[model samples]
Target: MLLLGLFSHLLSSGKFWTTRRTNASQHIDIRFVFVIFFLLKWSHAQGSHPPRIVEHPIDTTVPRHEPATLNCKAEGSPTPTIQWFKDGVPLKILPGSHRITLPAGGLFFLKNDEPSASLKIFSADKDGLELEVKGAAPTVLRDEFRLEPQNTRIAQGDTALLECAAPRGIPEPAVSWKKGGQKLDLDSTKRIRIVDGGNLAIQDARQSDEGQYQCIAKNPVGVRESVLATLKVHVKPFIIRGPHDQTVLEGSSVTFPCRVGGDPMPDVLWLRTASGGNMPLDRVSVLEDRSLRLERVTIADEGEYSCEADNVVGAISAMGTLTVFAPPKFIQRPISKSIELGADTSFECRASGNPRPTLFWTIKNNRTIVFPGAPPLDRFQSINTEEGHSILTLTNFQRTDRDLVVVCNAMNEVATITARAQLTLDSQEDRPPPIIIAGPVNQTLPVKSLATLQCKAIGLPNPTISWYRDGIPVHPNAKVNITAAGDLIISDLDRKEDQGLYTCVASSRTGKSTWSGYLRIEVPTNPNIKFYRAPEQTKCPNAPGQPTILNASANALTIV
Candidate 1:
């Protein structure tokens, strides 16, 4: 019985020790799980904050000689200590070489060390620098730029646009525009505007807008200009007067006007249509202010006219018509008076005006006739106005009709005028017969003798006395004497032939009268006859009253 009680006490003591060890192991495992959960939560919260930036806030673009700022910030427990590094080396604080100041209350300051702060630079290169903060470097720049409106065209009234851009720049560039060296002025009314991309814009375009345009972009480190872009504005010429056409009198005047508008003033010209001839032109006149003028217009002046305007940029033209006008007046005299008969006669009938008038002769017999000559008489004639004042001669005046009339007529010109006269016949009592007479009918006459002759006449207007001999009209010669008492006396007659017939004549308007006279001469017979007989003498014959011949030497014999 004593050995069984000692074995039961040893088993109970072993059970209590196993239970205490199990409880202690469970408490240690729970504590380890709680610590692991807190660590994971803290790591996730730190990742949510923005990364610390240490380079320039703006990127890639800067103008030369302009101010640039560098930034350095940190995000950590107790604000982790901040420092700067360049080219993989730590920077030391130096006196007078570095100016450090805190703008924002962060655990960092700006570095003003010009030489040390400068990043790697390339004149044409656009890439920016990488900055290191707290032994870690991050890329801090994003930049983009472009010019707007690749290509475009515009008419005079239409609108147009030009643009430039840089979406994001480290330091945004100032943008501007120029055309052929002149700056552009912008207006909202003109539809011109500028935007964020640094673009240049043009709203309305005209022919004057057709040229080169330049776009400029500038930043702190440098400035850039874009290649020239050309714009073209197209337009046609406009006519001021709608199809200006007209007609005018041939000897008058005409005018045509043309007007145009553009950036550059356009040229204007006038041209003709028929021969394509150009009209001479000058600057607008004060009187008419038109493009053309035609004075003293004529048929040859009729034609179409063209108005043309042009510039180095463009050109245009318009057309018009012109017409000319012509009209008719009298050319010769119509009145005449005073003419005669048995002689030539003529009259003039001339009518004066524009367009010559036709002339004809109208006789008193109511007959219309051309002039009497072979070819025909002209408008004028000459007549003798002597005896019959108003009489027109028909050549030899015969016992024809009494009152004759002569009229000159101009057809389609004027009224006619007539000239007339009365014809008279001669009387027989006004005519006279010729006369003759004779006297002094003896032949033989003594030296001193008287001769007488008688004269008579017959005529209408009385005849005068005159005598002629040997073809001479009885004028006194050297030794001849004449008396007005109607008798001839001869003082001493030397020859028997001195006695002959003499003639006396008288004449008058009606006829002629003539007379003749004669005279005789006598001589005494011989008183004594003496005869001488020579040695041998011949006998003479003796007839009827013959006397016998008696001869004596010294004495005379008488015969009875």
Candidate 2:
């Protein structure tokens, strides 16, 4: 009974043990299954996940006529899909879709859908249809900027305007004004005012304000400057006189009248040359009409004269000139007449003037004559000048050289004066004539003989004509021969003792002329004599009856 109870307790214990073990096993199995499920879920969560989309930018701001480009991008598991939208509406990718489709992802180009669109907005559409839109503000770009009244002139105590404007700009820029490299503040002054849009008004300009004014424009991105404008101011002074230029003859008195006009009568001071040549008050007199008078003008008076009018504001001046002139003058000797051939003549023409003078000579007739031709003879003869004097010399005067005139002219800067003289030739009768004469007055000759004689004459008239012997004119007589053109004659030869001196004379009304020569006569001798005899044994060379007698003296002789 005890053993049976033990066994039964063991069995019960065993059953309890078995039940706990089975429970533990079941818990372990459930844990094992849960671990495998967690692992699978973690693995699936770590694999290739889709990327998340973030910021998207699209440019919608562009000019009305300009094209625009939109940038679309996405962050996704495999780069999430991207698309474009217009005016908050999805853009369809199809033909005839007014909203044109572009390549997806990085860049998207689009035209301004509405040609007149202004202030439009563009957006990027994601695959989830998420919209990211932004608006672009229209900008104005400035092109040209300039200033009005670029240059101006204003009188003292007068107002002038300097205006500035811009043609086109992205933003309305601020305009500022500067004067002489310094900024001009906006204020209402007694003589200046700054107006809107960079306009400066000179309420009352003065000489001090005459300078350059510049306008500058300022903007967010850049700064632009314009040309500087010049401003001139004019003020009146006291005295005004002219010829403002004056010309006066040398050694003459001149008066320069200074007329004064101004608010207050200002004393006039004459200044020669701007530097140091100022005329003293005593040298210049102030007339009742406010005229500046100069007593006598000299060459020193020729220069710039400043007539200054002085007051509190400043001193204003006017300029004038005084000129002195010297007239031309001539100093020369007169031309004189002269006679005689191969003689030297002189004429003097000296001129003195402001400017030197020129001298020249001219002939009247067309006759061709030698140089220094027949001075005061045969018409007029022009003599050339060496410097300012004319010289003439006639070489050998003939009776034909008469009634000529020599002229000399002296010319100065202003005028020309001529002096002339006439030539009177000496009478021809006062000259002596040459003399001529002939010789062999007369001669006697023997019968049947030869005679030679000659006659020559000399005279100033070159005497001509017949020869004479014993006052009888001789010619070529046949019995009494003459030769050498009747100057010599020869009679028949008769005897040897007939030679004598003969006289010949020639005469002209101008003078006596004479000449002479000798005449010679010659006669021939008797004929030659000869003897001839007959041969008688070569004897009886002188036999009285057999001998021959010859006489050549006889005109006729006999020979035996």
Candidate 3:
């Protein structure tokens, strides 16, 4: 009962507690034991509250050689001791290392140091969160730093992408494009854009966009440039200067010049359609300047010529007209001929010229013949043939057609020529009387002087002439005789008897005709005799052994 009461008192005790020992000599204070147990359990609970970090040191990004900070916060009973570690090792504050440390028992920070460090926080009990410092430096690398699309060719209206290939760089480079040493207006030009702010893009490019392009990169690391890229905008061939209309003479050499222009140098070819077909280009030659040369061009070489230039984009051509000139020429000419009565006789004339010529025929006593109709004269026919061949035919030739002369005239815009021929008809009855072809004119002559008269006539069998004086037949005398050529000749004759009208008569199988004219004989006039007439002949002073000559006075001498 006493022990029970004691145990109950111990249980009921607030401040002190009692305990029993297994050995009597072993005496221990129950209050002391309870205090010792409470102390140990409190210690265990305090140790159980490890460093509970509510905020860990976060990663920070900073530029090189700049000030930055990393923060850390934690909680624990008995106040955890804060420390900093880098890369799993404790970090000690170094002298003059430009590092800042915060004063705190549960929160701390690092400042003014390189961000390259991987920081962490740890208490005396456990490790907290990991920390990171990101450091960046603006620098340009060597590789992948060139202008894209180097030496590229594109057509007009095509899109061009010109990029600065700077794949890896710090502080991202700003790309700018230039052409022909001039900056491009990326903001103003609607079709030109800076793609992703790193590449130059051109949409619907034209010939003006063809040039050397450069890409420039600028940043805090200074400026860097990429190699120049050639951008070519192809276009169809254009003929700036070429052969125009040309005029040249035949049998002469000629050259046609052409200039072709495009984005890329264009090739040129010459073609011509001339002289009934395409020109034999194999025989022709081309000069270094792309001029077509023809060695001795003829009239047949006149036609239209063309110069064509081609490239990958398209083709262009220009036309030139060639005019070759030649003088008029006769291929067939009119010829002289004689036809029997009621026979057909035709004359033909053919000519060639640069321009086709007009043909016409004209007769001596007939009307001219032209195109669109036959000969106007009866029994005459006009025929037109190919290649300027003209024919004039005379049918049933009559006496009127004898000794007829005809002419073939060919004329063009440049030249004119004519061919003439005579036509004769074989007819007898309808022929006129004997006609005199040639004769001598009648004139006065001195008495006792040699005189001759000629008469020429033409007939079928020829004609003879009869000489007459004063309308009387004259007999042949010693000084007067008739020649075989129907010529009357008198060596010496008396003026009174020989001076009279003269006539020539001609006869033919058809008829006879005579022509007369007065042929007066001239007489010599004597000088008048003086009143004191001297002797007819007088002798003057004579030389030795020489006969004396007498000077006859014309005024004093008279014929007996």
Best by lDDT: 3
Which regions in candidate 1 have their CA more than 4 angstroms from the true location? Answer: 1-83, 92-155, 163-237, 247-249, 257-268, 273-287, 310-315, 323-560
**lDDT at position 363, candidate 2:** 34
Q: For model 1, where is the 10-residue window of minimal lDDT?
A: 29-38
Worst 10 residues of 3 by lDDT: 29-38
lDDT of 2 at 50: 34
Candidate 2 per-residue C-alpha lDDT over 22-108 given as tens digits, one digit per residue, 9 for 90 to 100: 111100110000000001111223444433335444223344334444444445443445644333334455665434434544333
The parts of candidate 3 lying over 4 Å away from their true place are: 1-150, 155-185, 194-200, 203-229, 233-237, 260-267, 274-290, 310-315, 428-560
Each prediction's RMSD over C-alphas, in Å, is 31.1, 32.3, 23.2
TM-score of each: 0.30, 0.29, 0.46
Q: Residue by residue across 1-560, what tens digits does model 3's lDDT show?
A: 33234334544554331222221111111110100000112233424443444554443333334455545555555455555544345556676655556654221223332323322222111223222222222133233464454776777887888766653444566778788878888778799888765777889989788899887776554566677899888876789888788877777788888888886678898888666557756557889889888778887778888998988777889888988876678998998775666788889889888777888787767765545256446776666777568888877888677777888888877788988987765444445556554343465666677666666565544667777777798667898888776666777856787767777778866577676656566555534422221111124232244322221121221111
Candidate 1 achieves a global lDDT of: 0.43
Residues 1-560 of candidate 1: C-alpha lDDT, one tens digit per residue: 22123224434344221001111111110000000000112222333432234333322222222334444444433233444443323445565543342443121223221221223211111221122222111111123345444455566766656666643332456777777877777653345566545565555656677787777666554555666777777654455553378867656777776767544566676666685573433321313344576677766666787777776556778888876544211122322322232433434444322122234445654453544232432322323222212212244433342233455443332233333322232223333433442222344444444333334443333446665432345554443434453333344544443555556666654456556555444442323422221111124232356443221111232233
Candidate 3, TM-score vs. the true structure?
A: 0.46
Evaluated at residue 252, the lDDT of candidate 2 is 65
